[model samples]
Target: MAPISAIALLSFSLLSISISLILSSNIIEDLNLPPPPDFRSTILKNCKENPLIRYCNAVSGDISDVFKSTIVAQHLCNESKNPNCSNSFTKIDLSTRPLIAPLYLSFTFFWKYCPLTILTIDLSNNSLKGSFPSDILFCSQIQSLDLSYNGLIGEIPTDGFTNLTNLTFLNLSYNQFGESNILRLHYFARFNSSSFLRSGLLAKDRKFNVGSIVLQVFLLIFVVGIIGCFGWRCLQRPDLLPFFLQRKHKFTQAVLKAATDGFSEGNLVGRNKRVEIYKGILRDGSEGLIEIHRGKFSFESRRDFVEECRILVQLDHKNLVQVLGWCDNREFRAVAMRWTDGYTVVEWLSRNPQWKHRLKVLMRVVEAMCYLQDQWPQVGCEIRTSSIFLSNDHEPLISKLKVQDKNNPSKNVYKFGVFLLELVSNRSPHEGFETGETGFVEWIKIHYRHHVRKVIDERMKTTVITFVQVKQAIGIGLMCTDVSNNQQPSLHQISKMIDRVYQSSLVSQSATHRHKIQRTPTNALKVNGD
Candidate 1:
């Protein structure tokens, strides 16, 4: 009797266990959960098959709340309907329960709806921290993504959304990833006008509509056609091609790396406050130089590049350094300029101490500045000593001179004259003696009133410069640098004054020679017989 009783108990226990297992499997299947195709099925199946994940159907008042509680549960509970409940989750009410870290639940759901037209995994307002999962790349059909307001860090990996080629709306803002890496994903959107996702959720005007789409398509077609036509035209009429077009250049990064020999220390050409210039050679054996402006990669940098290009193109002058073109690509941002084989005026003056050549160079620079001021009245420009360069043969030149008033209607000639003074005296406009705290112009006026020698270049001590010539130049420089803008002379007036100074110097020298001849001794005199 005892043996029979023990056998019955064993049979009952076995039957109960089998019934429980069958019910659990049925419940998991009935849940009809989705699965992420790319992630391992074992992981997905385990999460889905877990009794905790099935509690939503048993006791769910709200689906979102049930999922939230289950997500934070300690372990799978067979008896309790709310197995994953936690006190922390009770205080927080989330719009949607995004399976935060152990992402098996979300992964399964994604795979099950494998061909979903748009899979929006918006976990915003959740205050979730840590880097975004690498497995997100598996969502091949995800057309729109809103991962904003999360505490995602590190880089938005290039491979993060590599498979999400169909993506249109991508919002990863209000996060910690650096903006520099954003360009890596810029090409993901289609060329269609409607393809671009407008930034800022609140910006109603930013959204792209059907009209925008048509415009975008038209623009794309237009651009492609123009590029094709340009290439064809260049092939037909080679002479029409510019220097940059003639030489097929690589992308900015490749060119920079090759030119700098992998950015080696030896390749650094020059360093300024804003940029570092480097010498580079293109694939077609064409020599070039590039300036790497200091700024982090962002939308602002993109805008600056456009502005810089516009400025360079408009202010075209022979004396100024020519901007060949600019490059704004994903990995590199730089400006390509014509490489001038001339030393700076400072270097040239230091090497060649000849006063005559220095004077000639200074005059040439003055002439260039004066010409620019006269021609481009809209561009009130200035040429400093630093802007001047001297050729290998010690011929003076000027380059990289910028316009002071880019949008001014009337010309400012006074500023041009002040620049000439700096070039002539080898003194900065701010330096030298002032008459009444006005500046270099006032200083020049004081010197002219007193003595020319005080303001003249010391190198001209042995060389002759007439008082009249000095005074005229000083007067012109003062006129250019006058406090009142209208008091400045016109370019025509400036040209006349320069001519007068030259004539006066010649006349004064001629007079001095005649005086010397008059004072010659009678024994040394040679008589010219008629």
Candidate 2:
């Protein structure tokens, strides 16, 4: 019995050992299971290499908060701080966040921080400045990027942009890109060309072959030689040059009387309180308009008038009518202006109903105003549709006497805004409209927000015009005409705004034409004026 009991005890001990071994094996397996991967080290390594991170660290600024917050949100924080991992975000919108830094550094920041999941990054209106942020190409996973309303300059680098296979939307408008040749790049094929508005960049890729370059150099040398010889001849015998080119072409009273056929009633074209305008032909067969001041003046007053005429002639601009010279004789006090063959804006619009043509003319008029504002801020000139002439090719030319008003440039801004409304609505600023509005600007303001179709010209209704672009133009007009807003945009700013609208319309047209653009030497989208 003792032997049997000892055997039973040994069997029981073996059973206990087996159970313990099995449990220990299971515990060992559970302990051996691999832990989740920690991304903290990787993130730190990347941040260390990130130039923007280092820059922020050195400066001790809150700019790095964007990066730090991103890290925490991605569950890439230190284990002691936040144990539980959170779902990561796929977008980082820092638009209008008022970032003031070198633009390149911002690109570097985006490059290192943007993850594979990131789809959109907006860094617009940050007042960023510098060359184009080509470093943004490293963010290959991003599908949308907006860097508009910044002060970026230089040529847009086309390299590696195609690597962003997922990219779908891009906005680089209102920035200062030096060239617009990017429109020809295949990477930007899917994007809207209007994304380049207000860039002040013209689409022109001038590729000169070796042979063509050599030929151009030869022609340049030949032209220089001809000019040099002509200059030498002028120096030797000034009489050889035409009197008109030699100096201000002063015409005598007898010559003016004969040119105007003795100032006959048939020759008179217009008359105002200050002057009488008459068609005339100079001795050199040059046709022009003679403006004879109504009354004779004192010798001092005549001298001042002659000085003013000299300055007016010296004010050279493509949009301005050429001043031939002045007449300060006893019988008449007149000024000669070279005749330009074109009708006034009002007459021209009557013939051409196309919105593009009218917008082109308006652009030139604004440009001329900008030129006047920039080059001759002290010189005053009045602009009206009747006084604004569109040449046979639709180039706008301002025709009027130079008035002395230091405050006229600011006034011109308001006048141009009114002109925009006039050109768009086909209604005179002076004429009362059916909307019970006396002023054209007020009429446009009332209708542009909701009833814009009614505000636009009836002729433009038949044409294929983009309503958004028209609205943009009308909005600019409203901004300019707003008397309550003291911070009115300058003529230069207005010129750019109009140019943006014009370019946007051109893009829409080109897209409709199956993206076929007729390229010219100056610009691909420039109209008749250019």
Candidate 3:
């Protein structure tokens, strides 16, 4: 009876507890994101330095509390639902991934929350309107970072970023990064100019050639036979004169606009849903290609769009279409790439209807891809026929390289296999799937050994190609299309394999030609006389 009474009281307490609780309808409301007043006060108290205080004051009105400012910092920890200090500090794991640490998290708070276990800090693109942090370098455990896309006004830390060998991938784009100290990027190993990108650093240095500026303006006015060019400018206003002179400079809206001739429709050379390509002459009198953003893009905000273009303009590789500079004014936005003559890859392939010629062109494309991959380890985008362009000399050039989330090297290999199939079959990737017979990879697997020859384009069959060469190409393609990255051959390995076949074909053709000459009556008489 006593035990029953005790159990009944406990049950009653549990029932009371359950009845007292009331769940709110908006459990995921905005106010829930920020911490209570005590947490905010604690964060503010910890931010002792002048820079941190200035930043806090600027952002305080935006967030309900300090917790709102720490979204990116939360990702640094494994499960930081509430960033409260618990442990006395220790070293962090350097192998952990770097994140955007664009917050005004103070060193005091850093130790409190990080607690010796946090591997890295991230505060990128947080609109931290202030000077740089005073003492973040005290965190010995921090390996990598991202202080990019902030408005922190100052020279980069004199301490340098390469102090930690384990650190990789530091992006400082779109910030007021330029000061007298920042001469070149490689000086800071972890933060480079060309790779993930360092924009605005070199904008002041691009120094659009002055000599070419005068020549181009002269060419523009005289060649068009417009004597009123000076009068036209004078009538337009005094402001227009300075604009024309400085158009020869970079990182300005007027520069790109003048280059595109006010984005005229008559100069339009290419069109797409997202971008418009226009042919134009740069301030240097050299022809240029302009890619204008016409519609909504992958960017979430205008800032993101500007940041993306800023990064893109910094990349330079022989294989990559040369991105000279960009424009991001209030209304107009564009990216300028080096102009090249001739047709897209489709036209080149259609004109040169030979298997050997096509193979060589494909090899050049592969070489370009390999270079791109080597220069930027993170680059692993799809390689399609449409993305490739052919110069007048038949030089294959990759027109674009868009970095995306799915950066598995195997993805590129798979796309290459599809490209190979297109070249061999002379059919688009979706051409055969209309009847639902099978997908490209599945069809190839089904006809691997038997009736494989039937899939080859009838035009390609005219050439006396070796069975081994054809089989090698087909087998390589099949392997590339495999689901597993481990199973697929690397681009370097594929290049070697292709080169082997190409050399064999060259040797075989030469031998056959020599045999023909030896058999000829005129050659036989000349040889006998010798």
Candidate 4:
């Protein structure tokens, strides 16, 4: 009897050990133990199959799948946290991975948890192909997404990414997307982050081949620099000018008047808050615009015009409304910009029903604003949506809008954020509306406080303008137009906030749409002059 009992105990011990071994092996395989076969291939396969594997591989081998599963399951199982993520979800460090596909996929697969809220994907050295997937929108929780240095092709899908509502950083550089394609992505805050997408392939290739082009540019710059260095160079020695200045095909005002048919109202191209622009042709058949300001003319206004001309001369961005030259005769202070054949951003949005185009427009506007705020800090300007004009090609052009305070850079930045909110909300600036209130900000506050739906535009109610984006925009707008100017974000911080707001808005829209929450159209009146 004692021998039989001992045999049974030995058999039970062996069975228990076998079970433990199998469990350990399974955990190791799930956690991608014993080092990845090849980090790149592992990433690629996991991205194509299960993005969670990439996240799993990011951690140390000792960190078992049970731990990860526990955290993920905790968030998923808990009703309150399932909508978002628990505290443990925020601790995931996805920045270690070099590939974007896995990170992008992981974020998408477990979007409900917001697993990648603060992670950065640096796929800068990968050979990944195909267009950015619509599933990328699911990463609304991610703060930074870097897909630079990859072989991504095709136009970025502007409409599908309404899901990434929390993303603060985005980078898609050194790819095969052409000049036009790159221009299309100029609206997103991510594109303007650094020298990542500085020059397009077309521009770079042209610069490489055209040596004379470079020389000419350098010569022009050298002459300008030399003039700056020597006070008597160009300023004092006006008579000893270069041949280019000497050769002139100047046109008389009478000739310009005739070409424009006596400056007919029908020839008018645009009317800003300050000036009316008319299309005109010179005797040599060169076409341009002649601007005529209707408001009070003063010495300060003249100085403003000259200063604006100087700034315009220095500007070279594609999205900016180009200024060719200016004429300041005794009677008028006019500036001639490149003739834009399209309408304002508002008008363009009104006409185009496609969300893709609208998104492209929004991104372009944001990018242009960021460039202006960053590159030209001296302007100390804030862009008002009323100042943004669109050409016939539907390309957005950010005009020299309001200078909030030339001396106070902080004020300028604050106002700039407000302007961004205007674009996001499809509302006019504080002063753009003809209502009794000073601007949309005051009106929004009043409506918000009163719980009135009239604050929202009627046209946008039935459209794709989700409640989430609207709320997010309102929140951002409030933050930007905060009573305390000191709290306003810098250009970099504002860019990140804008990215986050955009991501959140997308997520909110997705959630609302997915849940089929039918939004009732509020009886709102058109506030701006159509």
Candidate 5:
């Protein structure tokens, strides 16, 4: 009876335990509860351990805690209603959430909540401002990550990103990332280049040293300076310029022929054995005077012709005729100059005979002579009234050069003396002297000192004329034309003496005019009344 009682007690205890277990299982099934209640506890634990999860609660001021709790309740309810409900998140798409903070995640939180391994995390267009999130390195399993169109700055964490072996697609475009080492880009070779567009993460290969950059700049400046000096020199000597650069003053035979109307007789203004001058309309519809060399020449002569033409074309001065261009051909070579429509100095003097105008014309002529002498000391230019043209404003333009007179500066001075005599006497050098006299200079010399009044032009005998100034000018001419002597002054010195004479003449004229004004009857009456 005692053994039976002990066995029965043990069996009763075992049956009670089984009943409790069955009742608990039946209650759980009837209530439609979830598999477990540890989900909420696990999330709370993760929030404590994960900085990103805590950030949500801190940024939302505990509001995110209530929201997360509500989400938990809803998830629990859904799982209770549907046994197949999933608890793992493969992707977390928080794109275009402008109020969200910069993203960060922890491995423990990610593994606990998303055990299947996170495949994508899109946080683009969030206006999230900060450096690249360092905590993203914990989510190494993420295959497609997007953080584009944000305000993220600082260098990209390339070293930490290399640990993400599972990452396949990355879109960090439109962020403000800083430059990094070029070697770091190789770690992301598997991804497309567009993934880093506008992120400022593209490493530039800055191989140029400061020294090399400075050297390149210095070379550029040196080249520019050399070119500038060449240009300046070419302005004075156009023949020295490159052939292509000289094309402005080069012309073809066909163009010149068309301009001069095939060198017709009607177009011929003057002719000589060696040269023929034609007045022609250029292609640009402007009048041009063309001088064509008539006879054929040797190679050296042609070369000399070209060299002379180039030099003549580049002689730029207001008181000189501008040679526009030149044309060279197998048949002939031609020089072109702008056609000036004005009278010779002799004709102009006949129309305007005022002493002031005459003095002005003479001074400008002297200046032009000095300029030519400076340019070609060995070549003498014949200075005479016939070789000077007067513009509408009475400005003198020296037009002719006596190429036959070479290496003779005295000849230039003699010619200038003859020109001065002609200007003052208003008589042609060819006709003024007696038939028996030596030349124009001798005729002027004989009458200039003793019979100076006779040598002066009758037209300039008015009261406005100052005889003292006239005597000074005649003296200069006489000195210049003294052929028996070889002590002729240089052209530059002659210019200075002429300038001084002009200034003194101005003073004497003013003084004489003042005396005449003081002697006037109106002035005497005013003085008597006072």
Candidate 6:
């Protein structure tokens, strides 16, 4: 394994070169072409400092231009309904990437970023020089790949290529890839023998040497050992793999752009200024919402979003909004969610003016908070009605939940207390307090005790059931939000307390009505006598 200093030096050395040196022992320094005219440091920086790092420079001419073309093509393709649009949209045609410079293949880059939407890649005429790209193992969605008339070298990898089950068309002509029959790809059987005829099949036949075979076997083992070491480091500190490689489900920029109309202003329904929310309709006729967090791409931002996606995928709950997938490319980055038919808590309150109707919503929201506490503890503890959605079934779901810095149970309960205050009063949290920082529990302590009725929402038509329920719900909110205690009650305990208080409140309402009916029986007695 290399030391940190060695890795740094190697990183810089790789940065200096336009592409990775091919794995051939026979070096050809004489084949070097002159650098492009009017080259600037910014051009090099685009490749070197890119989120994909130097992989862009290693592949095609004018690294920035290549990324722009691909991203724009995604937008156009997402807009086009025609299946044959690929013939008209030519920038994404990998077949023509290198007219000026030798194309160094970006196996790793394409493998990591290519969504299922991309089906074909042709680098047939480019002067690409590299070993048979083993990185195509990640490109399982690709149905066609052409790499003919290139200066590629090395024996073709058989084991890795077997993953590309969808490959129906393949061409590898006029390349320097080795004719080692022992290393022939069995997966290539999907294509006819013509695919490899003028390429590796008839290229320079290697002399048989037992020592050379032994050397190759040892080298393979050595490479595997180094990879294992890096895998171990990745476990210790997760950033090593780059771009949060664990995120498997990805939406193409084209699909997202089409769904969002290139994130048009007309489709936008909500905005916090930090993030814009747009309504989207996918190609499959399903509807969704797109949350595009405003920011340019930084390595950390990309890593964080990918991490967020990974966590969102694991969480399954009726109260939590369903995350479909994510779209990330040079053009846009966002999280896609299944659109809800219901409104925000504020809007729902206006429509459902009955006190009893709102009480039912409060109970469901409590259950969701308790679940988050039990599963992730304090990680997603922040609560507000604005962050919640009422689905068509009248269930609540959480959205845009960020990772918290500290696991403060008291703070979470305090927010829940304010959420209760909002529901009981039919007012936003901002209206309850003069300042946002002041907890709602403190406002309750200062004002509400004997005059809880004064604070209950007057807009709602009060009933016997609701009057009792509001009193009990506020009581629970106050108790849960008490930060004076050295230790706080577990969310499980708080949830049960709400359940008991609510049931008793319902019983009180039923008993109150029963007594009222019994006292009014005189009229019925007189009617019976007549």
Q: Is 1 or 4 the stronger prediction by TM-score?
A: 1
Off by over 4 Å in 5: 1-246, 261-268, 272-274, 283-286, 402-406, 432-437, 505-530
- Candidate 6, pairs of clashing residues: none
lDDT of 1: 0.51
lDDT of 4 by residue, 339-433 (tens): 66666666655653333344455556656666776777555333555667776666788766433345465665556655545554456654467
Ranked candidates (lDDT, high to low): 2, 5, 6, 3, 4, 1
User: Which regions of candidate 3 are displaced past 4 Å?
Assistant: 1-251, 295-300, 435-438, 461-464, 484-486, 523-530
lDDT of 2 by residue, 1-530 (tens): 22222112112222322343323423323223332233233334334444333222422343343333332223221121223222233555667766322422443544544445456767788777788777666667788888889989887777777778998888888887777466767777777667766664436222323455788999999999999999876654443467766543676676777788989999898898887999988766888889888565788888778888877887788888888888786546988998888889889767645777777977888887777677776666667888888888889888874747455655778888887887888878766655432356776777877898898877775434576777788888888878685878988888888888789878888776763443334475668866
User: Could you tell me which 10 consecutive residues in candidate 5 have the lowest summed lDDT?
Assistant: 5-14
TM-score of each: 0.43, 0.49, 0.49, 0.40, 0.48, 0.48
Q: Which of 1 and 2 is ahead in lDDT?
A: 2
Per-candidate Cα RMSD to the true structure, in Å, reads 25.8, 33.7, 30.5, 36.2, 20.6, 30.1
lDDT of 5 by residue, 1-530 (tens): 22222112112222323343323423223223332233344334445444343222433353323323323322332322323223333555667756432312222232222322346777789888878766656556678889999999887778888878888888988887767532357777777668877676665312333455788999999999999998766654454455667558777666677777888888999888888999998755799989888566778877776777767776767787878888766568888888888888889768647665677677777787787778755334556677788888778888764333356778777777777777788878667456522476777777876897887888885353467777778888888888787987776777887787778767877888898888888856565568
Please report how far candidate 4 places residue 308 from its true position, in Å.
4.0
lDDT of 3 by residue, 363-419 (tens): 776776677667765555456677777777667677776645446677777787877
Query: Candidate 6 — which residues are off by over 4 angstroms?
Result: 1-248, 437-440, 463-465, 505-530
Q: How does candidate 6 fare on TM-score?
A: 0.48
In candidate 4 the C-alpha lDDT for residue 153 amounts to 70
Q: lDDT of all the models against the reference?
A: 0.51, 0.66, 0.57, 0.52, 0.65, 0.61
Residue 482, candidate 3: Cα error in Å is 1.2
